[model samples]
Target: MAPVSHAADRVQSLDVYLNACKIGTIVRTPGDFNAFSLDPAYRATGGTPVLSLSLRAATGGLRRDPRPLAGALPAFFANLLPEEKLREAMEKHHAASVRPGNDFDLLAALGADLPGAVRVVPTEGARAVASAQAPQPPRLRFSLAGVQMKLSVMKNTGKGGGLTLPLEDGQGQYIAKFPSLTFPGVAENEYANLALAAALGMDVPARELVDKADFEGIPEEFDTLSDGKVLLVKRFDRGQGGRRRHIEDFAQVFGLYPSRKYDGAAYHDIAAALTMAVSPAAALDFVRRLALCAVTGNGDMHLKNWSLIYPEGDGPPALSPIYDMLSTVPYLPADGMALTLGGERSFKALTPSRWKAFANRARLPEPAVLAAVAATAARVNAEWWHLPERAAIPAAVLARIDRHITLMLPILAECGAG
Candidate 1:
């Protein structure tokens, strides 16, 4: 790809790599928009690394011409940057490389350690193999999506197992999520919700709670915000010996920008995508998770929270392990789901008929969908009712969860769950 001269310091084009194989170039067009084009050889090759489902054509080949995206980077690349508070911190920390509100410079500054196996680099950089094991972390060179304040950290191998910042050259194995100043007991809420999901048979990632003191070399600003503890969640995208596995969220799968993550999509759209891109079984698992979220009062299951992982860095993607689940009722008393389910957003409106409607819209078997929902509701009822006191759930949050479950019972019974 040839670069067109726009400005002296502006980046004209970026080379995109997936699983360490060069696949395409994101070029700056004359209209001031950025567009991606797959490399001819990479597109023609068989069994190559997968970029994204949204970019793939019906013939199973990468599309030659995609609509140019507005702004400095395409939607896929823009979704890779940190959002809100974290984005501001990153811009200030790497001011020399990234200008405020500039997505291109931000990607160039920390391209090597993005969320999935994909990396976007200036065309002149050396080809990067994502699976190569580096001894140290990339030294605050990584960026994770979402508005929450978190850091990529590694758990120490010693007796105490303290969490430490990654030094250089590698991705952090865990994400350290601190408490929120505005929302009390946020970390504990998520921990309890995830625990309940796990008990109800969802494939959740390993997680634990750690004191702020347990973190070594954390930034000073986090100290002033939440309480003295944080939650440490293991990253599923990294496998044996820290090898990178490719993944893409629903936002990227639908080719939508992060700004529109909660809008323009419904639960049926998600189920449809799962059925088409992954499998019927994956879509059914989604129904179970959706029912569980409703029972637990989790109102934030947005597009970005759901993902698909390519285990072998190629085709046949599967639903990713659950992450970022929590009860929003404690914070928002009348909280509803992030996306509409069967023409409704209220958890209380998720009746048997609504689920049936969702199944019909998605072309899934109605009987299987209702069964998944009912089974999930029953499991949550059993698991939460018998949870030990040692779970340390905040009093108000636990009470709220119990109240929501009770509210779901009458409706759940109609769906064959009691």
Candidate 2:
């Protein structure tokens, strides 16, 4: 392995260490913030409480943490230390001898002491490991959180690479997402978008940006090493009242009920999942989401990016909230969406007739769905400018985003009319 870069070395030094012995044990009553006994032999080393970690179950057969060293810093960092003090410490610890291009062995070094079942392989040029199947030491570990809980990391394949993990905290579940490199002034764009969506009464997952350093015993990967930053988001699998449910991507949902498949064919469009809900009301909710995505200029919307949660019960399935909602048009160099809209990839091809046809094929009530779409578009347009101001996005970037939104506004308006 190449020498660890100054930035990676600093991150490694501050990463939290997880006690493998606690892999399948429940943390007893919280005591001393960080000191929680997962088992007699294993315990989490931290001065702050654990909000959550993403792990997978042994039975499900998912790859354990494919990149174990890429842990997010604990949220307690900001609360525990002053910003200037933390920055100074980081600067002092930065590895001055290491070069920028050196491949840092973060996961390998960190996982050396971990159990055999978990692997942490380091990627030569990338910040994160690709997969265990790749010709490298396993960089990630999928370990049981408790007897009944598991955790695993999910990467954001967006232009800005980020990390997210599904954490099952006893009967409660939440997703934790990390921050990624962005333009200097757009630091808090994700947080602002989430807050604004919440204000619009969207059922979004609970999210917060936290400092990783405050938490004691957290892995170094989670903290801000060098110039990189991280954020954490709670999973939506577990709901209030101790409800535990299975999370299925749109593809999985469609595959489960073949009868509801579109025209006896696999429904690859995410909109199909929203339209297939048994309740008309739920279908209408999806229409609102589609309009919101368009109005917000989230052009990267695709089937894989969305999911449907099937709670363990007889309740009807509902649409997951609008996530990955950054202004993709401005951020990405692509001219079209990841998935074709209205059977075409060209934005000009997304005509009102095509949308109406889509609604009809999805079995959605035209009037109700159109009304919801119009309402959501109006709300997003009205609130679009507020997000940049609140997030402190640079005026130049904000103007660029505004221009893209303006160009797409007419198309969004047409979708609402269908």
Candidate 3:
């Protein structure tokens, strides 16, 4: 993969790496178009495909030609960078990286120290990861797309257990989320909902809902109320001792930007992508999670919330540990499922026929599809109902959940019929 030369440090190419080994190069053509090609040696090494199914051909390698992306970074490289306010913050911190109408330069700025093993180094000198020079609190607008206000943080060792503070530039070990003024009891709401998903046997990350008083150096706006709760979630993409493992959300996998994250992809497309890119077991896991999302009345499983994880050395990717698992039914009472399933987005209308269509669309074996559906339905019936109340979820929010349960009964009924 030889890089073409350009005039006066225009940054036309970037070297791509998986861990320590160089894998490929991404280039910005004369017209600000993004194109990519893998190292011929890298493909021969029995290493897993770096980009996703959309970019790489079905035979498991990048297409013979370099191609421009339809959305953000080449499907594999997009989510490695931050989004929304985090994007704004990173841009403000590294002013040189932001050139109007140039996407590749912005990528070059955020490429160093990305989420997973994949690193993007500019044709120039090594780039510093985008972050504040020192650890800073939630001073910059902390709001992201979600209703709840959240920030990237590290587990604070100074106060010992049950304390976390802002993490900047360096690898963040956790994500700190606070209650919502619009949605009351969201901390407890998300906590109880995540617990339900865990009971159904998902690889959920570590999370705890703590009293607001336990944290220090945080802006009071984090929790909205002085006595509210704060949710501290361990970063699944970061391993022991802050090592960065490779991870990419469905948004990045499909080459969609954050603005298009919700509308750009559908659940059927996600399932199809998983079947081609990952193992049979990993594909089955995706089916199971989709089933759980339907029964739980979670209408917010957008592209950003779904992700894939790659193991250390050479290994095929698998669905990452589930994060952002919360039931939005209580808050967005009028909303339906975030992404469409089998040509429809309504949970109530996802009949067995549609599910079978989804299975066929995903190219999944009928037996595996049936098994995943059965497992999810049985688990929800056995373990879901009592969770929120037992978790001591607030009464008003619990009532909304109860109402959502009544509304979502059709999905459970369909599963029970099978």
Measured by lDDT, the strongest candidate is 1
For 7-118, candidate 1 gives per-residue lDDT tens digits of 2145667788886789888876676677877888787873266677777777865666677876657677888888988888777666544668878667766777889788
Off by over 4 Å in 2: 1-174, 182-187, 212-229, 239-243, 255-269, 347-349, 387-389, 394-396, 415-418
lDDT of 2: 0.41
Lowest lDDT 10-residue stretch of candidate 2:
25-34
lDDT of 2 by residue, 71-151 (tens): 221121111111233223222322242222122222223322221112222223423332334233222222211111112
Which candidate's TM-score is highest?
A: 1
Instruction: Give the C-alpha lDDT of model 3.
Output: 0.67
What clash pairs does model 1 have? 137-168
Quote model 3's TM-score: 0.78
When sorted by lDDT, best at the front, the candidate numbers are 1, 3, 2
Residue 326, candidate 2: alpha-carbon lDDT: 55
Alpha-carbon lDDT of model 1: 0.79
Per-residue lDDT over 230-300 for candidate 3, one digit per residue giving the tens place of the 0 to 100 score: 77787777788767677777887776766777799888788887876787678888888888787767888
